[model samples]
Target: MNSAEFRAVFRYIQALLIITQASLVLTDHREMLPPSPADINWLMHEWTPTVVRETNYSHRAIIPARNSQTRAAIAKVTTCDASAALTAQFFTEVEPAVRWLRSIYVV
Candidate 1:
């Protein structure tokens, strides 16, 4: 996705968080594409921290992680980057990811 689209997604997520009053679980089933430098910069410098600051929990499951070491590393880095703002984790399977998210909601 382009930078603008990425920004829009953050906005959408923010809105969803407000409306649902719930934690987020983002699962991507598609093959990974390296984000543009601009997109990465925006995510690191702006979106990741700002949007997540008020968030209590947000998890991202990379369904393709089992096949990609690069993706697994990316997931780890993303969690670290947002660690101060919220709880974030990555999983290779959706079921476990959902279970983790559910557990957080109950806590």
Candidate 2:
């Protein structure tokens, strides 16, 4: 794929990961429980690498170094009831990443 297409896919993957993290937070909050191993497995198995491959195939956009950091943060938050501090951090980290991803989109 061409550079633009690849960038688009990279951006989509970033956005998808951000969304999945947010969804995990919301689900955990609603359920009044920490995220389970199953939840993490689903995120890793069901969502992550597929998006990465698609992104790579289309745009060859480099994955941000911070992506893993963000995922780790999400995992930490998910593993327990989120404190106000954790919630604040999650939004702080996620919003900008999402915005960065959105900026790449053509539409």
**Candidate that scores best on TM-score:** 1
Lowest lDDT 10-residue stretch of candidate 1:
61-70
Model 2 is weakest, by summed lDDT over 10 consecutive residues, at 23-32
Task: Write model 2 residue lDDT over 6-91, tens digit each, in one string.
Answer: 34653565686556432212111211222344544544554444543433222211222235544453455334332221222223
- Per-residue accuracy of model 1 over 1-107 as CA lDDT, tens digit each: 66677668767877777677666656563465555566656666666676667654455544553335436545544755664555556566778877876766664
The residue ranges of model 2 lying beyond 4 angstroms of the native Cα positions read: 1-33, 54-99
Q: How accurate is candidate 2 locally (lDDT)?
A: 0.38
Error of 2 at 98 (Å): 5.5
Candidate 2: residue 59 lDDT (0-100): 21
TM-score (C-alpha) between model 2 and the true structure:
0.28
